[model samples]
Target: MKKMFKLQWLSVLMLAFVLVGCGAKEDTNKETVSKEDQQVEKTSYKVKDDRGVEVEFNAVPKTIVSLQPSNTEILFALGVGDKIVGATEFDTYPEEAKKIERVSSSTTFDSERILALKPDVVIAYTTGGDDENLNALKVLEDAGIKVFAIKSATSFDDVYGDIQQVASVMGIEDKGEKLNEDIKAKIAEVQAKVKDVKAKNVYLEISPKPDIYTTGSGTFQQEILNAANVKNVFADLKSWPKVSEEDVIAKNPEVILTTVNYTENPAAEILARDGWNSITAIQNKAVYFIDPDISNRPGPRIGEAVELIAKAVYPELFK
Candidate 1:
């Protein structure tokens, strides 16, 4: 009976040893898992948007919905086009954007549709000042969808900031810096080409006919004019200004650049204006049409806009 008890005691001790080993192994696995959780937590980040709102991301956004064409273009330029599950109807650039689902119109936003898309974030624009769009974005925010509002860019510096903002949010800061550098380099090349050219008086019309709209000071268009070695005849005015024919006649621009494409021949329409025939631009036949998209959108194609303006204003030098 004593021998039998000794054997049973030995079995108990062995069982206890196995249990302790299993416990130690389990603790080591728990420690490893905790360390992995910490590593993942380190990847989270926070960025302040244009509205001075702090937005935090647990990881790079897996999906995006861009509310502005400029924002869409910027995202595509950053090589994140595949992640854009929703965009505005106007996002027709880069070909790939056309295939994405449209969540907003020029004047309307479909909050229900955006919510249905279930994007990780929504990139919005504050330029339009449309209450409806703002309301839709509010709905998205209330639904726990991240909404980042980008400020309207008014200059090249602002454009760079916008690119950086989008890049930072997408966790591709290096790519954003490279893009800005490329844009700056292209602008520098155009500037160097026009450095020896004389600055000319230019009237850039964004709208036509009875309701004439033109860009003036404190606008990206004006900056493009400056970069191209040209003077905006309406520089004295601020932002987009509506002026009478008399005002344009008084300015007497040497070169007229129009972004009107609704008509078949915008340049011809400008040339045939009642009193514009007497203007120097009309006499010199220098009324040129600029691609509205490149010239208007403050995105990666700003350098092309500068080149277009420079070449139009100084054909001899550019050629």
Candidate 2:
């Protein structure tokens, strides 16, 4: 009777082992199917950029070269940092960007260096690429490398489109959509915080006194100032207009904001401007400095820039 009981116990153990083995096989099969589905989901199509250049893709790119810092920022934001083989010297965000090879910066692009990298796609922009050497992009195109020109954005909506363009080329439009929504949400949050406050006339000094340069209506800096409920004293002007001290004094801006970092202390320098004792901004000590990257670099951090400007304009509301 004892021997029969032992045999029954062994049979139960064998059945349990078989059930566990079947469960493990089921999980393995599910993983294989998931991978197969992912492979099957990828599709290819034609895309045209701001420059009217079209490129066809067979699949997602393996390597990329970004000449524009804003475009580079967008590429990394969309989870394509691993694919970026080269970027400009100014591409300093996400911390991982500094690890990539520098192929372009300011007004320079190295064709030989870019050729050595053999990137599948290259991102350039009209505002930054409008130079004699920019034709080097054609040399890369002749060699079967795809080139896409990012648009010269004058407003925040244009920036959203820029992100979508990069995301689509990388086959990640959903990520772009999600990112733009987040940006829009953050902008709306800043707007709500300062919506009821009185708008202040602001003078945006992009350069030092004497040869002072400032942004006007059709620029990203002006859009941010407007969102913060601050009026640009140069709104009637267009592009980066050079303003005379006489005209600025006549307009009499309440707040003086500078993005110029070439000097050690921009606000202090503003305070020491010649013949400005009666001006409201200098008199009330409303001179503030903004980081050029936050205001000038058009990318995913624009909402942060807008918020920073808003705080500078109305610290009481933000605080």
Candidate 3:
């Protein structure tokens, strides 16, 4: 009987050992399968920018080169400040972006210098690729660098949308969505107060010096004016056309808008111009100064620009 009991105990021990081994094998298989699945499921998307450019990355780029100050501001806002390996001159706003390597000088890009840094992505403007500066993009592409061409922002939506768009390209889609919603709400609130108000013809002056440039039909500044329900006097002029004082007098502009960065106040200087005093905007003292940093930069601050203009152009509408 004792011998029989020992045999039964040994058999039970063997069965228990077999079960434990099978369970361990099954767990190991599951872990291996999980790792394989993760490898297969990982994916990323390529975005085609304004210049008909295609750029690819590993879902989220670890290093970036910002070619424009506006783009730099957008990247910082998107919480990807650490990703930026280099930035352009005058990327001073927000204070922190200034610390990055200055790869571009005065809106001009240097591909050779940039390529040496081994950045994962490059963000630039089509306008920055003008006659004075060769589009440094081709060299970077030939060297296997990723270039993300940011389009010139015109309207309020473009400002907000581009922020989200860049975030998406950088694989921070959630942050982009939140940013877009916030700007949209802010814009809608501003628009709600200004809607149904009578529109005025506005002449947006770039400068009041030897030559004057004004925002026209195709310019982004014109879109901002339209958003505020102000009719641009040079709306018929194509793409930031030059105008004379006589033109302003003939147009009979009800309002004048210009960059605030000028040495002299644009409103006061324009009123002092030879023929500009005859303009209705001057006669009514409707000329106003707007901060060029906010007004001109085609970035996230455009909503603030709209509000600034709305208040200056139609103070009664806000109240």
Question: Candidate 1, which segments miss by more than 4 Å at Cα?
Answer: 1-42, 127-132
Which residue pairs in candidate 3 collide? none
As for lDDT, the candidate ahead, 2 or 3, is 2
Question: Model 2, 1-319: lDDT tens per residue?
Answer: 1110011111221111110000000001111112431321234555677656666666667899987677777888787787899987777887999998987645457777777888888876653334333465677787778887665666787788888787767666668889999999999999999999889999988877668888788777888998888999999999778889888888899999988777889999988988887889999999999987777777888899899899988989976
Expressed as tens digits, the lDDT of each residue in 1-319 for candidate 1 is 1110011111211111110000000001111112431211214577677666777777778899987777788888888889999986778888999999987655566777777888989987654344344555676798899998776677788788888888777776667888889999999999998998778999999878788888889777888999999989999999778899999999999999998867889999998889878789999999999988788777878898899999999888766
Error of 2 at 296 (Å): 1.1
* Best-to-worst lDDT order: 1, 2, 3
TM-score of each: 0.84, 0.84, 0.77
- Residue-wise C-alpha lDDT for candidate 3, range 1-319, written one tens digit per residue: 1110011111211111110000000001111112431211113456566555555555457788987777787888777777888986667767888789887765245666788888878876553234222244666777898877655555555666677668656665557667767766766788888888889888887766677777688656776787788888888888767787778789998988877364666677777777667778889888888877677777766677778888889998777
Per-model lDDT: 0.75, 0.73, 0.66
